[model samples]
Target: MAKPFKNLRDKMSPQAQNASEEKAKKMLSEMPLQELRKARQLSQKNIAEVLSTEQANISRLEQRTDMYISTLRSYIEAMGGQLDIIARFPDGEVHISQFKEIESLQNSKSAQSSG
Candidate 1:
């Protein structure tokens, strides 16, 4: 026996969805790598080890304040996650499909090395 997933689109009120999406975007913009890594139960040393780099390199990445979207994508991928970007229109209406597309972009960016 298992519970089926709920339809998030049907469940979310327009106001709630707007606020939640805005919050997500703001958080992503300000998020530090250290917090994300810790939340994933990973350490800088662990990531450095995987990347074949020194632990100090991980420390610098964690302290980085500016996020290059491409870099963020790769880092997130290494943690078994992905980054996304979305836009809100003049009426504050966001397309639901954009979420999925953004995820694909993240995957592609991570896979690319010369971008």
Candidate 2:
């Protein structure tokens, strides 16, 4: 009684198929932090352990709409991902390098403090 989705999709025009694929790609590209974490197969406890914080803190951080860049960077790093700050313009997009520099500085400071 039910048709397979792949068979239905095959009946679509090439343009329609391409549009559907593009929409799916867009959906996969953007997601909230909570969804991203789950997609990466990580739990709040896992991130907390890597970040040296409590699980409650990780939960609170994921719910906030606003947070410091360093805080966000640390959270993303704990999940084994690098955070990139991108500035989109009418002409093109630019990747902001200042945050990368900040991360390097923090790493150096941490190394010095530990050693």
Candidate 3:
């Protein structure tokens, strides 16, 4: 009564398969923080431990519609990923490096102060 998914997929034309794959890639590229965490096989407790925070805080952060870029960057870094700010235009896209420069400056200052 049930058909195998592989068999169904195999029956599709090459164009349809390519389209389906592209759609899947697009969907994967755009997901909420919660979905991304789950896709990475990480739990709130795991992220909390990495961030030296509580699980409840991680939950609240994921639900927030607005958060600081630094907070978002730290969260992504805890998940073994980097965040980039990109501005898209009609002609092209630009990577905003101001945030990265600020981070570099802070790191250098901290290193100097510690030494």
Clashing residue pair totals per candidate (backbone < 3 A): 0, 0, 0
Error of 2 at 85 (Å): 1.2
Per-model lDDT: 0.74, 0.94, 0.97
Ranking of all candidate structures by their lDDT, best first: 3, 2, 1
Ranking by TM-score: 3, 2, 1
How well does candidate 2 score on lDDT at residue 28? Answer: 89
Off by over 4 Å in 1: 1-31, 93-115
Query: Candidate 1, TM-score vs. the true structure?
Result: 0.50
lDDT of 1 by residue, 1-115 (tens): 6544346645889998889889988887675678878878998778877777888977887788786665666677778885666668887865456656766786788789656
Report the lDDT tens digits of candidate 2 across residue range 36-102: 9999999999999999899999999999999999999999888898888999999999999998888
lDDT for position 106 in model 1: 66
The C-alpha RMSD of each candidate to the native structure, in angstroms, is 11.0, 1.9, 1.9
Model 2 worst lDDT run, 10 consecutive residues: 75-84
User: Candidate 3 residues 1-115, lDDT tens each?
Assistant: 9999889899999999999999999999999999999999999999999999999999999999999998999999999999999999999999999999988988899999999
Indicate the worst ten consecutive residues by lDDT in candidate 1.
Answer: 1-10
Residue 26's lDDT within candidate 2 is 96
State the displacement of the C-alpha of residue 73, model 1, in Å, after optimal TM-score superposition.
1.0
Give the Å shift of residue 13 in candidate 3: 2.6
